[model samples]
Target chain A: MSLEVKTNVAPSKTKVMTMKRLKRREKIEGWLFVLPFVISAAVFFIGPLLVAFMLSFKEYSYLDMVSMFEAPWVGLSNYINAFQDSTFLRALLNTSLYSLGVVPIQLFIALVLALIVDLNIKGKTFFRVAYYIPTVTSTVAVSVMFLFIFKTDGILNKILSFFNLPPYNWFGDTRLALPTIMMMAIWSSVGLYMVIFLAGLQDIPMSLYEAARIDGASKIQEVLYITVPLLKPTIFFNLVVSLIGTFQVFDQAFVVSNGTGGPLDSTMTVVLYLYKTGFRDFQMGYASAIAFILFAIIFILTLIQRKFFGEETEF
Target chain B: MKKLIALFTAAVMAVGLFAGSTFKPAKVNAATKKVIRLGVWASSPAESELLDNQIKEFERLYPNIKIQKLVITGDYNQVMQVKIASRTEPDVFYLDVYQAPAYIAKKVIAPLDSYLDKNDVKDFEPSLLKGFTSGGKIYGLPKDYNTLVLFYNKDMFKEAGITKAPTTWKELEEAAKKLTKNGVKGLSLSIDAARFIPFMFQSGAKINDGDKPVFNTPQAAKGLDFYVSLLKKGYAATPKELGVGWNGDALAQKKVAMVIEGGWMIPFMKDAAPNVNYGIARLPKGDKEGDLVFTVAYAMSARTKNKVEAAEVIKFLTGRQALSMTAESGLAIPSRISMGGVYTAKYPERKPLVDMVKYSQVYQFGIKSSKILDALNKACEKLYYKKVKDAKTALDQAIKEVK
Candidate 1:
C-alpha cells in the first residue's frame, strides 16, 4: 500500500507546480522592467543625497581633495557659519519674498487666462499653442530677450518715451533688481501653470454646472462651488511644484546679475548663495550645509502643504 | 595738562593700531619633481592662444611631465577657488596683483622662493615684478598687463567741436558736457563694481586694512562721490540703465563720446567701429594724479601633475615669443617690454597702446580685492541709481558690508 502511494504522486500535483512557475516568471519580468529606473535612482539620486548629508558636517575644499574625508570634523560649525553669514540671511529673505511675490500672482494670472481659453472660442488650439510657446522656450533665451527689452536704451524705454515716462535701470538698481527678476519669472512660468489650469478646468463635471445653472446659481457662485472643489487636486500639485521651483531658483538670478548677485546682492537667492559658497568660496562643506538647509526648508514646506491640502483633508 | 596727556596716549594708540604684522613664508617642497596644475583667466583670445602654444613648448623641453592649463573666462578667481578645494587645482593661475595675498595665506598656491632662486628673473619689469612679490618671494610673473586708455570717438569729438583728447579730469568733464546732446551720452562709465577698482586707484583710495575693510576714509568717499557725480550729471550710465556689456559697444557706436577701457580694447574698437574715427589716449588723471593699471599674470598650478614642466610653460608663455605673439594678436599689451615695441613696429595703429601703458599705475587693492571692489561697486550702483543720495553714508554702508 505504501509502494502504491509513492507511485501515485499525482500528475495534478506536477501540473500545479508548473502553474506556480509561470506566475513567478511573470513577476520576475515586471521587476526586470523597473530595474533600470531603480538602478539610476540608487546611483544618481540616493548616493549624492547621502554624501551631501555627510559632507555638511565637514570642512572641505577642492584644493584639499582628500580633505572631504581627511579634514577635521566640525559638527554644526558650517550651519553656524551659514546662520551668521548676513549674505546667506539676506538671500534667504529675498528668496522668501520672491516666492511670495511670484507664486500667487503667476497662479492667478495663469488661472484667468486658462478660464478665458476654456470658453467656447474659435481657433482655440492656435491660442493655446501661442500661450504655451514661452513655457517651452529655454530659460537663457527668455532671460536674454528680457535683458534687451529692459535695457536703458532698449524697446521698453523707447515705448516709455512715447508717453514721456522715465526709464528704469532694471538690473543695475538694487531696489528694482529683485522686482525685475520677479517680473521675468512670471513671464516665463505663467504659461506652464495656465496649461495645468486649463486641464483642471476641463476635468470638472459638466453635470454639476448644469444643475447649478438650473438652480439659478450665479456664475461666480457656480465656479466657487463646483470648479474650485473639483480642481483641488490640481491646485495642490501646482502649489507644491511652484514652491519647490521658486525655492531653488538659480538660473535667472545668475544670468541677470552676471553671477555676482550684484546691484548690492539684492537679487541674491538661496541657491545662488549656495552656489557661491560651494563653488565660489570653496567652502564645499558650508555649501553642503546650505544645500541641506535648502532641502530641509523645501521638505518642511512640502509637508506643511501636504497637511493643509493632502487627500486626508477632502476639502 | 590732562588734555596733553590724552593726546599723547591717542597718538600712541593710533601707532599701535597701524602696527600691521608681516607675512612669514611657509615651508614648501623645493627639490622634489612634483607636478602642479596651473589655472589662468582667459580674458581675450590672445591669452588663450599663447597659453596653448607655451604649454606645448614646455612639454617638448621637459618630456618627463604633464602640464594642464585650466582656462577660466569670467570670474576666474572664484572658479579657481572651487577647483582648488576639489584638489583639482592648477599649481599656478592668474593672481590679480591686489588679490594674491589671501590665496598666499590660504597656502593653496605655494611660494616660488626656491624657484626664484634657481631662475634669473631680472629682465622682467621691476615694478611689475614687485607687485607679485610678497614676503620677498615671487608668486607668479605678469603675462599680460593693461592700463586705462581714453578711447574717444573722433567723429563725436569733432561734432562736439573738440579736436584733442582730454589729458586731465577738468578737461574730460568739459569734453563730456559738450558731447552731451539728445540721444547721445558723453561717456560710458559703468557705475558697477568693475569701474570701482580703476576709479578708486585713480583717486588714490585704499580699500583694505590687512583682512578688514577700511573704505571709510575721506579720500574713498571723494572717489565714490566723483563716480556718482558722473552719473548724476548725465556723463555716464548705470550698468543696468545702459544695459550690461554696453561700455565698449556704446563707444563703438558713437553713442558715447569716450570710454575708459583697458589696452585690449584697441583691437576691439578698431574692428567693431572701423568707420567711426577713434583714437586712444591716457586716462584723464584723478585729483591725486595717477592712472590705474591692471595686470594679470601666469603662475604654476599647485595641483598640476608636472610642476617643473608647468613652471617652464608659464615662463615660456610670459617670455618674448609668447609676449610678442600676444601683442601681435592685438588683444592686450604684453608684460615684456620688448613685445610692446615689436607690436607697435608691426602695427603702427596700435602706437596709442604703448603710450597708455607708459602712464599706467598699478592697481593694488592688497588682498580680498575682488570682494572689496564688489562692495564698492554695489554702493556706487545704489548712489548712481538715486537709491541713496548721501555718498558718505553709502560709502560707510559699503565698508560695513565688506567688513
Candidate 2:
C-alpha cells in the first residue's frame, strides 16, 4: 500500500515542493558555500582570460602594464601571424607530440599502479605514499635531479660505463630530449591519477565481481569485462586533465634547457614559446594569440573526447 | 536579513585578511624624511657588504637622504620591468648595458645628460659610457665593467708541456689539443652569442651592419667553423658535458684546463678554487683583435619622485672613489679609464681584461633585435650539438630565418 501510494506522485515533484519550501534559507547557505570560489574564479581566472582574449587582437607589449586600452587593435592579424610563424607551428607540433607521448603512458602506468595498490597486500599505505611523493615534490627540484643523473658524465653514465654499456647523452640529443622530459612528466604525475583511480576503484561494488565470478569468469575476464568498464569515466577524466597539463608543459622544459627550449627547439612546447614571446620578446599580443589558439585546440579536443566517453555511463 | 548581512561582512573581512600586504602599492608614507629605495642583487655576503658600505658613505655625505636598499629576490630585469610598469620601482637600480637599448626605447629610465658634467664624462671609458648613451642622451652612468679574457690552469699547462699561455689562435688550438688527455677536457666552451661575437670580431667580421645584425657573412662563418671544430675535434666540451654548472665551475673542479671569463673570475677563483694556481691572458688573437665588455650602471628610474636625490645617489655611487672601492674588492674593473693603471698594478692578473677594453665593443643592436638573437642562438646550438655538419649550412639557415 505504501509502494502504491509512492508510485502515485513523481519523486521530482516531491523534491520540488520541498525545494520551494526551503528556498530562502537553503539558497543563502548554498551561495555562502560557493561564494569564495565564485569570487576568486571571477577575479583571478576569468578576469585574466577575458583580458587575454581582448589583448589577442591588440599590438601591445608588456612595457606598459596599463596599455591595454591604448594598444592598437589589428583585428585577427596577430592570430594570422601566429599561424604563419614557423617557430610557433613547430612549437605546436612539439606540444602535440608531448601530449600524445605523455598522456597514454601516464594513464596506463597510473591504472596499473592503482590496480596493484587496491589489492589486499602488505605495506599498502607505504606503496601509496611512495608513488604520491613525486606529485607533491617540486618540478624544478626533480628537473635538477634529472639533470644531475642524466648529464653526459653523470652518475648514471658512470654506472652504465661500469657494465660496458654505451653512455647516452640524454638531453643533448634532439631525438631523445623531449622524450626524456616526457618520461619525467610521466614519473612525476602518474601517482596523482593512480590515487584518483584508486578512489574510483573503491566505488565499484563487490557484487559485480561476485556475479562475474559466479558466471565462471577468469581473473583477466573479470578485470577486462567488469573493472575497466567501471573505471571508464575516471580514465576519461584523467585523460582530459593530463592532456591539458601536457600541452601547458613549461617548467620541466625550461629548467632542463636553461629556458632556451633547445636541442634545436625540439622541446619547445606552446606555453614555453608563448612565454618567450610575451616576456622575452615583449610581444604580448602575439603570445595572447598563441594562447587562444592553444585554448581552442584543447577545448575542441576535450569536446570530441567527451563525445566518446560521456554517452556510455549507464553500464 | 540582518543575520545574512552580518555573515557577508564576516566573509568579506576573512577574504580581505587572507590577501597579504603585497597587494598594496608601495606608496611612501613618511611625511618629513624623504626616502630613496635602492634595488640591488648580490650573490654573496661580501658583495652585499661592499654595497652596504658604499651606501653608508653616500648617506654620510648627505644626512637628509635615507636610502632603503631592496635586495632583489628574483630575475633582476624581469622584476625591474614589472616595478617600472607599476610605478613602484626603486629610485636607483642596476641596469645592464646590453639591455639599455630596450629600456631606453621604452622610456623606463631617466636620461642624465644634464646631471652629468663634462669632467665626469671624460673620466669614464668612452666605450663603456657609450653603451649607456642613445641618440646623444645618456640613460645611465656605468659603475664598472668586465672584458672577457683567457683563464688557464697553470698546473695543467705545465703537465701538457705548454709553458706560456697561448697568444694566437693557432697556438690556442694546439694548447687545447695538448691539454686534451686523461679524463679532463682541454677547454670549457659556451655556445652563447656573447662568447661567439668576440671570435667574429677577431676574424674581422662585422656582426652588425648599420642597425641590423649581419652575422652570416663569410668571415663570421669562418669564425663559427673554427669555434665548432674545437668541440668536434674533442678539444673542448660544453660545461654540461663535463657535468658542471658553467665554464668557471668546470675550471674550478679541474675538469677543464682553460676557460674564457672576466674580472668576476678573480673573486670567484679565490672562493671556489683557492688551491688551484691559474693565470689570465688576453683572448688569443685571431686574424685581427676583439673582445666583449659587460658593464652595469646605477640608473635612476623615470618614475622616481625625488629626481634630484636619486641623481645625487647615482653621482656619488659612480664617482671615482666609490667605483675605485668596488674595483679594490676584485668585483669588477671600474668604468673609469684613469683607474686602469692603479687597478692593474694592484691586481696584475686582471691586467689582460683591463688591457682588452680598448679592443672590445659593447653588445648593442637597434630596437627589436629579438629575431637576430633567437636565430643566431639556434644556429649556435645546431652547430654545437653537431646536428649541422658544416658552418655555411647552419649560418645560411640562421640568416634565412632572420631575414
Candidate 3:
C-alpha cells in the first residue's frame, strides 16, 4: 500500500513540475510574439506623444526643432495664447458644428442602409460589395472628384439648370462651403458605418425575431423592438469612432480648400488649422497646445457619450 | 529526422546563395563623387523632364559630382520649413521672394555673397537681385521670374469692336463693358491679395508704410474701389462667379474676354485653348506703370555640408544657357536682363510679359506677409461676395486685423 501511494505522489509531483514549465514557456512565447508591436508602439506612438507633451510646455519654434531640448520652457503660455487666438476658436467651433451636423445624419443613413441590405433580397452580396467601394477608395481621389462635382458649373449645377434652378457656388460660398464638405464626408463614410451595422444585424439571434413575428409585430416594429436593442453596443462603438473622426477632419478640407482653408476660412477644421499654425507659421509649441486641448475635448466628449448612450447588458 | 535536417540545411544554403547574388558591392569611386541634393516644388511633367535634362548636362560638365533632385508636390513651404528645422534640408532649394525675408532673418539660408561676383550679379535684373538681398547680403540667386500681363482674346476683341488692347484703366473699363455679352463676362480676376496688390502699387499706395498697413488711404481705396466697381457693374467676375477655377481657366473657356495673369499663362493658353487667339500686353497703366513681379531663387541651406559644391551647382543652373533652356518652356521669363531679349525672341507671345520687367515692382510683402495677405484677401473676398458694401469698410476692418 505504501509503495502504491509513493508511486502516485511521485507521478503527481512530476506532473505539477511539467505544468509549471509549460506556463513559463507560454509567457515567454507570448512576450516574444508581442515584442515587435511593443517596440513599434514605443518608438512611433509613445515617444512622439511624450515629446509633444514636453513641447507643449516649452517655447518651441521651427528654429529650435533641431535642438528641441534646448528650447525655453514657458509654462501654460502657449495654452493661454491658443485660447486667445480667434482663428483657433473659430476652428474649434467649426469642427464641433461639423461633427454635430454630420454624425446623426450619417448614422441614420447607415442604419437605414443596413436594414435595407439585411432584408430578404436578391444580389445582397453584390450590394454589400458595392456599398464598401467608397470606403476602400483613396480619400484624396474622392476629395478631388467631389471638388469637380460641386464646382459652380459642375454636374450638380447642370442638373439643377435642367430644372430651371439657379446654380450655387458650392465651395466658393462661405455659408455653403462647410456644409458642402460635410455632405461629401457623409456620403463617403456612410458605407463604412453601414457595414458595421450589417455585422451587428447578423449577430442578433433569429429566435428573437421569430418570437416577435408570432406576436403579430410589423416589420418596422420587429426592427424597433428586436434589432435596435441588440445593436446598442455597436451603435455606441460607431458613434464614438465617428465622433472622433469627424472632429479630426483634415484631408477633405485641405484638398477642397487648396490648403488655405479659405473662401474666408469657412471650411477650416481644427487639424487643418493646427497644421497651418504648426508648419506654416512654424509655431510648434502653440500647435502642441492645440493638439492637447483637442485631445481633452475628444476624451471628455466620449465619456459624456458613454454615460448617456452606452450599452447596459444584463447577465 | 536526418532527412528533415538535410532539407533545412539545403534551404539555408539556397537563401544564402540568393542573398549573395542580389547584394551589390559599394562602388569604388563613390568617395570621389560629391552627391548634392536639390529640392524643388513639383511642376508640370514637361518642366520636370526639362529639369532632368538640365541636370544631366550639369553632370556632364562636372562628372565628379552627382545631383539628387527631390521634388516636393504639396505644401512646399511647410515641408521645406520642417526640413530646415530638422537640419536635414537639401543642399540647394527653391525659395520664393515672399518667403526669402523670413528665412534670411532666421539664417536658415546661407548668403551667396562669398561665391557670386559683382559681374555675375550684374547679369540679373537689378530689381530681381534686390529681391534676394537683405541687409546688403545676397541670400539667393534669382532663377526666373513671372510678371503680371493682360491676356485678351482676339476673337472677343473683334466681337466687341475694340481695335487695340487697353493701355489705361479707363480704356480697360470701356473694353470690359464692350466685351460683356451673352454668357461671358468682360474680365475675370481671382480673389487674391497678390492679384489685387498690383492696383495698390499702381495707385502709388504702398502696401506697408514702414511695417504698418497704411493701405486704407484714399489712394489705395480708389484703386480697390475701381476693382470693386468693375465687379459691381457686372463687367468683371471672379473665377468662382464665372464657374471656373481661376483667371486662366476662365480665359481658356472664353467665359471672360480678358485676364491679368503672369507669364506662366502663355503655355497654359497654348495647351488649354489652342484654338483661341490670345494676345499678351502690358497691364493697363493704373496711377503709374505699376505691375507685380514674382520670383523664386536658388538658395542654399545654411546647414549644408558641401556649401561650395552646392553654390557651384546653383551657378551652373542659373547660368545663361540653363536660363535659355528653361525659358524655352515659356513658363517664366529669364531673370537675367541679357536673356530677356533672347527669351522673347524665341516665344514672341511672351514679349509683353518680358518687357514688363523694366517697370515691374518686386513683391515687398515682408516676413509677416502671409498673415497680412490673408487678412487682406478675406476683406477683398467679403467685398466681392457683397458681405461688405464698401471698400473703405473692408479695408478698415482688414487693416485693424493686420495691425
Candidate 4:
C-alpha cells in the first residue's frame, strides 16, 4: 500500500508541474506572436487617436507643432466653433444626406444581388467573381475610372446621347456632384455588402425554404417570410457597417473634387472637410475637434442603430 | 498643382537613382563630409535633368558636401507644412511665393540676412523677394520665376484662318470663336485664381479698398465676366470640359487652340507635343496688360541640423552658375534679374514670357492664400457653369466666403 501511494503522488506531482510550465510557455508565446501587431496598433492607430482626442481640447495649428503641448487650451471652444461653422454644418448635412441616401440603397441592392447570385444559375462562379471585382480593385483606381466614365463627354454621356438625352456635367454641377460620387460609392461598395449578404443567404437552412414551398409560399414570399427574418443578424451587421462606412466617405469625394469640394462645396463630406480644415488649413486643433464631433455622431447613430436591432442580434 | 505631381514622380525617379548610388559606400573622409538635402518641384523631365546636372556640378565644386535632391510632390505648401511640423524638413526646400507669407509669418524658414551677400541680394528681382520678406527680413532667395504667356498651336491658328497669336483679349475671343469649329474649343482655361487673377489685375480694378476686400465691386466683375463669358459663349472651355489634364496638356492634345501657361509649358511642349507647332506670346492684353509672376525660392530650414551646409547649398543653387542652367533648361526664367536678358537672348522664342517679368506682380496672397484662392476659383466655376446669375454676385459670394 505504501509503494502504491508513493507511485501515485510522485507521478501526479510531476504531471501537475509540467502542465503548469506548458501553460506559462503558451501564454508567453501568444503574447510574443501578437507583440508586433500590438506595437504597430499602438503607434499608428491608438497613438493618433489619443493625440487627436487631446488636440481637440487645444488650439494648435501646423506652425504650433513645437509648441504643441504648450499650446493654449480652449476647452470646448473648438467643438463649439465646429457647430457654429457654416461650412462644418454644411459638411455635416452633406455627409448625413450622403449616408441616408447610400445605406438603404446599398443594402437593398446587395440583398438583391446576393439573392440572385445564391440561386443555382448558369455561370455562377463567373457572376460571383464579376460582382466582387470592384470590391477587390483599389478605391482610387476605381474612383479615377468612374471619373472618366461619368465625365461630360465620357462613355455614359455618349450612351445617353445615343438615346438622344442631353449630356450632363456629372461632376461640374453642384446639384449632381454629390450624387455622382454617391453613385460611385454605391457601385464600388455594393459588391462587398453583397458578399456579406451572400454568406448570410447561404447560412439559411434549405429545409426552411422547402417548408415554405410546401405551404404554397411563392418565391418572393419565401424570401420575405423566412429568409429575411432569419437573416436579421446579417442585415443588422451590414446596416451597421455600411452606416459607419458612409459616415466616413472621403476618398471618392476627394478624388472627384480634387480635394477642393468644388461646385460650391456640394461634394464636401464631413471627413473631407475635416481633412481640408486640418491638413489644408493646418488647423490641427480644429481638425481634431471636427474629428471628435464626427466620432460622436457616428457613435450615437450606431447606438441608435444597435437599439433598433439589438434584441435580434442575440442568438 | 499638377506640375507638383509631375515633379513628385520625377523626384521618385531621382530618389531611386540616389538610393542606387547610396548602396555603394563612398570612400570619403567622414570627418569632412557634410550632407545637405535640397528640395524642389519639377514640371518636366528636363527640369529634373537640369537640377541633377547642377547638383553634380555643386558636388564637384564642394568635394566635402553631398547634395540630396528631393521633390515635394502634390501640394507643395501642404507637404512643407507637414514636414515643418514634424521638424524633419529638408535642409533647403522650394518655397512658393504664394505660400511664402504664411511660412514667413510662422518663422518656419531662416532669415537669409547673415547668409546673404548684399550684392547677390540686389541682383534678385525685388518683386520676387517681396513675398519672402517680413519685418525687413528675407526668409528665402528666389531661385526661378515664370510669368503667364499664351500658348497657341500654330496649326490650329492656321486652320482657324488666323495667321498670328492673339495679342489682345478681343482678338483672343475672336480666335476662340473661329477655333470653336471642328470640335475644338477656341481656348483652354482653368477656372482658377492663379489664371484668373491676372485678368482681375487687367480689369484695372482695385482688389481691396482700405483693407476691405472688395472684389465684388462692379469694376472687378469686368475680369470675371470676360473670363466666364468665353465659357458661356462656347468659345472657351475649361480643361475639365475638354477632358484634358491642364492648359498645357490641352494645347498639346489640340483640345484647345490656345492656353495661358508659363515657361513650364515649354519643356512639356518640346517633350509631349513637339510637332504641335505652338508659339509662345505674352498673355493677351486685358485693360492694362497685368500678368501674374509664378516664382519659387530656395529657403533654409529654421531647424536644420546642417545649417552651414544648407546655406552653402542654397547660395550655390540660387547663384549665377546654377541659374544659368535654369535659363538653359527652358523650364523657367532664372530669378537673377540679370538672367532675364540672357535667357531671352538664349531662347529668342521665349522673349514674350521674359518681357512680362517687368510688368508682372508676384503671385501670392498674404496668409490663408489657399482659402482665398479656393474661394475665387469656386466663384469662377459657379459663373462658368451658369449656376450663378451674374459675375458680380459670384464675386460677392467669393469675397463673402473668404471673409
Scanning candidate 2 chain B in windows of ten residues, the lowest lDDT window is B22-31
> How much of the true A–B contact set does each candidate keep?
0.56, 0.36, 0.44, 0.36
lDDT of 2 by residue, B1-403 (tens): 5456556657877788765453343334335556798988756888788889898998888887888899888777767766765678899999888678778888888899888897768988888888888888999999888899999999999988898999888998999999999988889997777777788788888766645767778888888778878888999998777777788999999998999987778778889999989999999989988888988998888878999989989999889878878877876788888777768878886789888999988876556456676777788888887778777678889878877
- Candidate 2, B-chain TM: 0.90
What DockQ class does candidate 2 belong to? acceptable
Clashes of 2: 0
DockQ of each: 0.22, 0.31, 0.40, 0.34
Task: Write model 1 residue lDDT over A1-315, tens digit each, in one string.
Answer: 243346556878766666787789889987776655555566768987897888899987655535566776989999998899888999999999999999989888888888888999998888888888988998889889998888877888889988999887777767888998899999899889999999988877788899889999999998788887778778888898988899999988998888878777888999998887676555778999999999899999989988877773232
Better of 1 and 4 by TM-score: 4
User: A1-315, model 3: which lDDT tens digit per residue?
Assistant: 244455646777767766887899999998776665565567768999999999999877675434778888999999998898888898999999999999999999999999999998999888888888888888889988887898888999999999999999998888999999999889889899999999989888888888888888999898887788889888998999999999999999998887778888898889999898787666888899999999999999999999977957431
| Candidate 3, residue A116: how far the Cα is off, in Å | 0.8
- TM-score of each candidate's B chain against the true B chain: 0.79, 0.90, 0.90, 0.86
Residue A219 in candidate 1, Cα distance off native in Å:
4.7
Q: What would you estimate as the lDDT of candidate 1?
A: 0.74
Clashing pairs in 2: none
Could you give candidate 3's fraction of true interface contacts? 0.44
What are the candidates' interface root-mean-square deviations?
Answer: 20.8, 5.6, 8.7, 9.5
* Model 3 steric clash pairs: none
* Candidate order by decreasing DockQ: 3, 4, 2, 1
Q: For model 4, how does the per-residue alpha-carbon lDDT over A151-238 read when each residue is reduced to its tens digit? A: 8779999999999999988887789999888899899889999999999888888888888889999988998888888888898899
